[model samples]
Target: MGSGKHRWKISIYRSTGKPETRNPNPPTEFICPISGLLMADPVIVSTGQTFERACVTACKTLGYNPILKDGSIPDLSIVIPNLALKSSIFNWARASMTDPPKAVELADALKLVRPAMAENGEIENGVLGELLIGRVEEDNRGSNLLEHAESELTRRQTGFDSCESLSGSFRKTPLALATRPSCYSSCSSSSELDAPAVGACEDGEEYVGKLRSSHVYEQEQGVVGLRKATRSSEDLRLSLCTPRLLSALRPLITSKYNNIQINSVAALVNLSLQKLNKVKIVRAGFVPLLIDVLRGRFPEAQEHACGALFSLALDDANKTAIGVLGALQPLVHIMIRSESERARHDAALALYHLSLVQSNRLKLVKLGSVQLFLGMVKSGQMPGRALLILCNLAACNEGRGAMLDAGAVEFFVGLLREGGFDSESTRESCVAAISALSYGGGLRFRGLAKAAGAVEVLRDVAEQTGRERARDKARRVLEILKAREEEEEEDVDWEKVLELGFPSRTLTRVGGQSCRNSSEF
Candidate 1:
């Protein structure tokens, strides 16, 4: 009996040695499947199964495919940094259409793991990863999925549409599903699909479908065509049109084609400026929407929006509205940050226009926008803009001291010296700066001439002036300096006139001719 018991015990121990029955409660720590190191954390398998980190890692490293919960190969199986995961997902979504089903499946799997992915301050990465995965899935499924996704997106986007209906849906159900022509047509064709009849509310208002005009519909179609053509064309010709295009684009800005309203507004703004009807547009409440577009993400839209604001600001009636909107700060910001030189130039010109109003100039100075103008002058990226802004600033008595302190004289002198007298703009800016300094009581003409190299530059400019008017300007400056010097001197310097290379013979001949001319008179 004892021998029998010993044999039974041996058999029991043998049964326990089998792999499946080895441990009822497996050890938490195990060797990593990939690195052969002890697992530090639990591994989540694609099948919603957790394993030892060591095992999963080793399985991945050795090419042992792990299945996801949906019976697909795991998309992202490797442990990676949060930023790396986010970047990978973003790139995947961006290129998702080109990738095959396996990549799409992987993205979907990564998306599933996103919530758990944010263990320690990786929330942004997790959220972005999930979005990327969703994008990939939608892209892989093609048009049907895209339509559905867009419908959902449109529904979500409706909240900010308009103010008329705050408590109820912002858009009609048909419009939300309008991306798919069949869906829209079927819903519109069937009276049964008309939204569940909303009854009259306590406020005695009956729910009704917002009716749109045929003109708006046509404008929307035109805008879509223009966008598509612009996407394909190098010159974007379809996007550019004369004022006549406004008759076509204006209706699209109304509620009928709300999705394309912003685009329509931009096109109309461009056309309006071309037509020089900005005054009318600004008075019609176009400024607020245009300002919003200027703050939007699309570069082209932002550019046109700024351009429209600038054109509107040029009108005296619209200037107050622009200031009330607190537009100067954002306009200045765009001028400083925009990569487009034309946009920067327009922004500067707009500021100059605003500066025409005394209050606007003071407000801009209070806002410290003058520093940006100074930077532009010092950097010399846009000399025309700098010159205009300086001219505007000098228009204000309060701004004159600031302009001088900011080295306006130096910049104008440099422009005059480096930019030849033939340059009308440089000559104008120089003369303006000199006149401002001389009148502002802040500039001693003598000190300015000696310190800013004004004497030599003016002398050269005077000689280069083929125009009688320009010669007179240069001669006047020279005369002012000579008169100032004479007043400061004790003795006459008639003997030194020859030493100084004066045209003595020309002077003597002129004097003799003057005497003869007087006798003749």
Candidate 2:
């Protein structure tokens, strides 16, 4: 290659010297060493290696370079932004799907189906699993389909059909069973028995009455189509298709086709794993649909909905919106009433997220969540999350007041000291709750802490803990109670809330989380 008057020699490696078949994918150096995701914010660390900024910051904070044995960097501030690499990544991402592979086309066109005979309502053993597994195998093979679909979908920017239109295929004729003709008993096995059609055929071919076609059969076809679509998109695991997929699946979820709804919800569960997809799904009207499923009679759908909401709620931005849309009422119901252990555990996890925010904490405590956590703690149902919820509640003064009134301080502390809970997280959570209640809730909390025998537990943990985090947290609580028992205290302020490592959480709990208000944004 010639550069301005200077010539440079570069060697190229190719198994076959065919330029047409040479792979065009990005080099391994372009990927973040820590995250393995494409580097949108690539930076060079002090170790002379580049990685995504977020991953670098986390790694540096842990005092080590993930890729090198160089124990720790002097500082992370020396990192440099890799703009040239970032631009190259952008170009690659844009052109990535331009040349689509043939496997993608075949996978999209593929169908898993049975003939009309399935209308008999009798499922042959192992047939359904084979069909679904076959479709999944195809989807798994066509790895590039989802990326192509996303690019194609974004280029068009089209909208999906309405709920009614989606339900069109579901409104079908009821299933009907076909009965055998009575004359079949006397019919001979073979040989040209020309007689009444029920008994025999003129050419020895069996004669039968006309079979009724069921709309149920047609609905099954629609469900199979959607299921295949969902499986393909789900297999790709890319957030790029999230919006379009949500648009397509939203209406299908409301359809009476149970299988269609199940597949759609399951697809949403997969899509919501993408951090960017959570807001889009919520905006496209998924939270309410999930809440409906959580309240539905189907335990499987309930578990899926609960799990999806739990993942979405991991993004603090979506928590209040989920709760604001009347999710709290039935979420609480599921925690208290759902028959499935997995459903109840998932519900508890969802509540753990909801309780992270101040207003939601207040609302939950007001709605009998304190008692709910108390019961869950006793039953071993997501005990870590239960304790975490109790701790988050104790962050606010009003919540602390309610929790103290409900005798949670004693329960949490006792659970910690007695080794009743085996998890380090649970034990740490109990200690953290005592810290929040001890330092910020005034003299009443100190007196209450001692009355609950928290001092003994704190001393035990501070003196005998293996985990440094737990030991430090316990020591902090012990200092607050011992050094300044009567120090002036107030509720958790906005600054304290920020210090607690929840910025986005405070945003929604306060106000202005609506996705619809574009102007405010």
Model 2 vs. true fold: TM: 0.51
Cα lDDT computed for each candidate against the true fold: 0.46, 0.53
Please give each candidate's TM-score: 0.42, 0.51
Worst 10 residues of 1 by lDDT: 202-211
Candidate 2 C-alpha lDDT tens digits along 126-172? 23322333332322422222222122111110011121111111111
Task: Tell me the spans in candidate 2 whose CA falls farther than 4 Å from its real position.
Answer: 1-245, 486-521
In the order shown, the candidates' Cα RMSDs to the true structure are 28.7, 20.7
Lowest summed lDDT window (length 10), candidate 2: 176-185
lDDT of 1 at 48: 29
What is the lDDT for 341 in model 1?
50
How well does candidate 1 match the true structure in TM-score terms?
0.42
Candidate 1: where is the Cα deviation over 4 Å? Answer: 1-219, 222-262, 274-277, 420-424, 440-449, 466-521
